[model samples]
Target: MVGIVIVSHSSKIAEGVKEVALQMAKNHPVYTAGGTADGGIGTDPVRIQEAIEAANTGDGVVVLADLGSAVMSVGLAKEMIDPALAKSVKLANAPLVEGAIAATVEASMGSPLAKVLQTAHDARNMDKVE
Candidate 1:
């Protein structure tokens, strides 16, 4: 089972998404990195790196970001991860809500990080089209 990392500007957002994802797939691992519930930004490179490290402990890791800053933060953290694990890290393009669902579903299916990211992206696109 691939693990998941939800990164957002707000920790509440990340936590909310993680909760929903967990509800969808009880056994999957869903870690979060982002701003705190008090609205404090949670874009620390070290924290992001830790979250990625935790997610990577499983088969692979899928990272979903809420915005550009989250993306840059995760990208920076990716550089700090082990080469083998970093190679498996991927960015999910699905929106906060849909991406969480897609990622959870894909992770539960034992999908590779790339495929999970693609599924999330596709789901986001589909949502946009609908």
Candidate 2:
């Protein structure tokens, strides 16, 4: 199973996305990283790294970020992780809610990391283009 990590500016947002993913992918591994759950800033590099490491047990891990800081924090965390694991990690451009759901569905279906990211991107684009 492919592991998933949800990063957001607000911890609640991250958790909400994770919850949706979990509902869609009951058997897959899902994790969240962010700040306080009460709408505070959730961009801690250490927390993001820990979440990624925890999610990346054996299967590859997919990271979904909400905003700029969420992505930056994941990038910083990647630098702190082992090189091999870092190579398997990917950042998804999908938005918080839809991206998490699409990623989770693709990952659960045993899609490659690249494809999962693409699915998330496609899902995001569908919303904009349709």
Candidate 3:
């Protein structure tokens, strides 16, 4: 199964999203990369990289970042990885909470990395008003 990583400037938000996503991905690896090393309201590349490494289970990791810095942090984390491992990590351009849920459900179904990434991306088209 493909793993999942949620990155957010706020630690609580990241952890909370992970918790919710875990409901669908009970058997999959779900990780959170949040806050700075000093407990500030910011993203940490180190933490993001660690989360990516921990979540990876050979299939690959789908990263859902909350905001600007969190997104950049994930990118920086990817840059820090070895070329081979970097290829296994994808920075998903999907909404954090919704994307995490969608990805987790897909991953739980034993879907491949590309399928999981597609499901998360599709969440962006969902219409809440319907």
Candidate 4:
């Protein structure tokens, strides 16, 4: 099954999203990469890289980041990890919370990495008013 990583400037946000995603896919792997080394609000490439490593399980990993800087952090994190493993990671341009939950559900179903990333991206187009 594809795994997931939540990246956020605030550790609480990442952890909270991970918690919610886990609710939908209890058995799916959902890791968090949030805050700085000092426990402040910021993104850490090392943390993100570690999370990506833990999330990957041979299938792939879908990363959902909160902001632009967080995305950049993920990029740096990818460079820090093994090239082969980095090749299996995809960053989803989708809403953090919704995307995480959606991706988690899709991955829990044993969906491919592409499908998981697509499901998370599709969450951005969802209409809440419907």
2 or 4, greater by lDDT: 4
Query: What digit string (tens of lDDT, one per residue) describes model 4 on residues 8-41?
Result: 9999999999999998889889999989989999
Q: What is the lDDT of residue 53 in candidate 3?
A: 90
Residue 90 of model 4 has an lDDT of 98
The numbered model that scores best in lDDT is 4
TM-score of candidate 2 to 2 decimals: 0.89
In order, the Cα lDDT scores of the candidates are: 0.80, 0.83, 0.89, 0.95
For residue 129, model 4's alpha carbon misses the true position, in angstroms, by 1.8
Residue by residue across 1-130, what tens digits does model 1's lDDT show?
A: 6788888888878888888888888888888887843569757666778888887765778888888887888888889888888887887777887887888888788877677888888876664443
lDDT of 2 by residue, 2-118 (tens): 788988877878888888788988878889887844547868888889999998866678898888877888899999999999998888877778888998999899987788878
Kindly report the root-mean-square deviation of model 2 from the true structure over all alpha carbons.
2.2
Query: What order do you get sorting by TM-score, best first?
Result: 4, 3, 2, 1
The TM-score of predicted model 4 comes to: 0.97
Segments in model 3 whose C-alpha atoms lie over 4 Å from true places:
none
All models, RMSD in angstroms: 2.2, 2.2, 0.9, 0.7
Candidate 3 lDDT by residue in tens digits, 11-108? 99998998888876677689988898898889999899899898888899999999887877888999997779899898888999999999999988
- In model 2, the clashing pairs are 35-42
